[model samples]
Target: MATPTPTTDAPFGLDPSGRPLSDKSKVAAGLLGIFLGGLGIGRFYTGHTKIGVLQLVVSVVTLGLGGLWGFIDGIVRLAGSAPTDAQGRVLR
Candidate 1:
């Protein structure tokens, strides 16, 4: 007997076992971005560690201007535009 290949159409963020790869929350991320955006905490919460760090650095270098970036990102996330994580996982 031949084994069937797994389908590639699986939803983003689901593991092979049919479970979520990550439990990150979009609302939490948005809130973090609006509240602590200067620190890139939302990016970190969404599993974008590198981006979060870069945001932090940029915010520090630009004298808190980076917070605006985070704020925009947060708004986008809340609006459902930015729903995926760096690993292509969909935020819950």
Candidate 2:
């Protein structure tokens, strides 16, 4: 018997560069941002601590209006255009 070789495909769990995908879920992050964006929940879930902290500060300072950034980010993520995670891996 021969061992089947693993294919390096995005849907197969490998990134374009043939690396393992991030453990984070795009939908989960999106939902978190849409609902608790003001709290930077999505950014935190995506492992972007700096962005999460900044988002929190901005949302707090702007009286929550700044949360629009996070909300839009969520939409973008859902649209399949989110950036890489803090560890430079694309979210799975």
Candidate 3:
């Protein structure tokens, strides 16, 4: 018997770079950005403390306009224009 070697052409279900995003923070961030993005809760959940804090401040300062910003940011992230997670890991 021989051990099966992993191949690069597995499928889209995994990351080609082999650094697949298994981090709960990233998933949570993505979800939050998608749903609660208006409040920047996603940013905070993903470890982007600076951005999260800024979002909170902006949302408060702008009387919830920051939520729009957060929503846009979430779109960009989900679209792959911005791939860094809260820990800055490029999602695959």
Candidate 4:
């Protein structure tokens, strides 16, 4: 039996369609999360509309308690987690 080898045809992080995935900005996202997390701005910027909406609702319902969640996420982003967008593109 022979083992399959990894193909190097396309660049890393590209889809089979040979198209480059959209990238997000980690710094910008972090800043948004830190400053406007209560409104889910970071999540929206990251293409996480659903999560963003949820965060907004949570913030509104909990009287900005959700901002803490955003703040923590910002810290994570700033720490070089390099989160991906909804399309699975890594944040630059």
Candidate 5:
């Protein structure tokens, strides 16, 4: 089997600074979710491949309605109400 490549962003369990995450990254992620949500960029950045793929496929199939949901999720994320990632760490 092929090994998975490391992502450009931080690893699944840590941030660039080796800390869990600060509120800053979470907020930034949320903004990305709002702006580039159609591409699932934020989901990928935040290490949510499943959700990201779903968003990408659904967006493609539904003509960007997935983007609308992602946009709303962005607002929820910015409000510090969205669920944390697999690592159980809140964004930034």
Candidate 6:
């Protein structure tokens, strides 16, 4: 039987920080973005407080039009092309 390679030994992969993978779930974040994007809840879930606040502010300032931005972001995340977590690690 072949032995499985260790995470450190995995080829062609690594977080930008050269650290272990994040435990965050893109699905969860995506859902939040889709349902509560105007509130920036998804960004907060991913540890991006600043972005979250910005989203919230935009949502308010634009009278909810900015919510489209968050909605799009949520779709992208669900598509598996999401950005890294605050720790610079890809979501699981």
Candidate 3 lDDT tens digits, 1-92: 45334444422223445443424444555667867876778777666778888888888998887788888777777766436656445554
Candidate 4 Cα misplacement greater than 4 A, ranges: 1-21
TM-score of each: 0.72, 0.78, 0.65, 0.74, 0.68, 0.76
Q: Would you give me the overall lDDT of model 6?
A: 0.81
Q: How many collisions per candidate?
A: 0, 0, 0, 0, 3, 0
TM-score of 3: 0.65
Candidate 3 stretches with Cα past 4 Å from truth are 1-14, 18-22, 25-28
Q: Candidate 2 at residue 32, lDDT?
A: 89
- Candidate 1 least-lDDT 10 residues: 3-12
Give the per-residue lDDT digits (tens) of candidate 6, residues 1-92: 44433375433345544544556888999999999999999999999999999999999999999998789889888997546789777786
Please give the ranking of all candidate structures by TM-score, highest first, separated by commas: 2, 6, 4, 1, 5, 3
Better of 2 and 5 by lDDT: 2
- Using lDDT as the measure, what is the rank order of every candidate, best first? 6, 2, 1, 4, 5, 3
Write the residue-wise lDDT of candidate 5 on 1-92 in tens digits: 45433344534445443444433377777888899887777777778878888888989999878789778767778887534655566575
lDDT of 4 at 8: 51
Candidate 4 lowest-lDDT run of ten? 3-12
In candidate 1, residue 3 scores what lDDT? 33
Worst lDDT run of 10 residues, candidate 2, spans: 3-12
List the global CA lDDT of all models: 0.78, 0.79, 0.64, 0.77, 0.70, 0.81
Q: Candidate 2 residues 1-92, lDDT tens each?
A: 45333454433366555565677887898888888888889999989999999999999999989999899888888887545667766777
lDDT of 6 at 13: 48
